[model samples]
Target: MKRILFTSTLAAALAAALFMTAHTVTAAPEGAPAPYRHVVLFKFKADAPKEKVAEVVKAFAGLKEKLPAVLSFEHGLNVSPEGINDGFTHVFTATFKDKASLENHYLKEPAHEEFVKLIKPVIEKVLVVDYVANFVDHGAH
Candidate 1:
């Protein structure tokens, strides 16, 4: 009974720690607003060819150069050991100066439209989350 109690307590403590770390946010420098972040996760269809996926990634990476509103663009394959990814294999993050730039300019850009068309057929599922970044104080505790 004592061993079971200890194990449960340990699990709860570990969960709390994970929750805190996950929610912690980075602080921006004094008086500067944090940029808007557009995060996209993709699960490619099982039948999608590797070459086609590579092409899609190449096109997405190219968008940073094409759109002035895009402060940065990055993409990567999922490398997490966590099994909860729900088959999402690729992740992309695009940063913008503000929400207007992302929603109005970048999203409507001709190159972006073309890139979407390139990716749509090969993707099984897509999840997008956008936020204006803000700092949360959780200084190492």
Candidate 2:
């Protein structure tokens, strides 16, 4: 009788542990902040003049001013010593409240279309990535 009781208790404990693990893996932690991040990297043509590149940069920075959905915007030229940039010189990051805000900025905004038109001639390559930012506070523990 004792052996049967011990087996049952062990099985119950294992099941509970598995259930808790699955639940934690599938659910976001309470109070986690989700921000949509838009990342853009540009590689200008080798023969593009410095003045034209500067103009493109200025036009891109001006996008935040024209778009209400842009929560924050920043950009910089790559200075990494790793030399793995693949000829990409400039990177621009913009944060929006959510995916819908980003869509509005990228799709419906005329300013964005104009910027694209401006850069098309000078751009050699472009890469863009967008995702929901996951912020975790390690100090909360």
Model 2 TM-score?
Answer: 0.75
TM-score of each: 0.77, 0.75
What's the distance in Å from true for residue 2, model 1?
19
Cα lDDT of model 1 by residue, 7-125, tens digit = 99999999999889767766676778688999999999999999999998899889999998999888898999988899999999999988999989999889999999999899999
Encode model 2's per-residue lDDT on 1-141: one tens digit a residue.
999999999999999876665544322356654778899999999999999999999999998888988889999999999999999999999988889888866657899988999999999999999988764443331
Instruction: Tell me the lDDT of model 2 at 93.
Output: 95
Displacement of the residue 84 alpha carbon in candidate 1, Å: 0.6
What is each predicted model's overall lDDT from 0 to 1?
0.90, 0.86
Winner by TM-score = 1
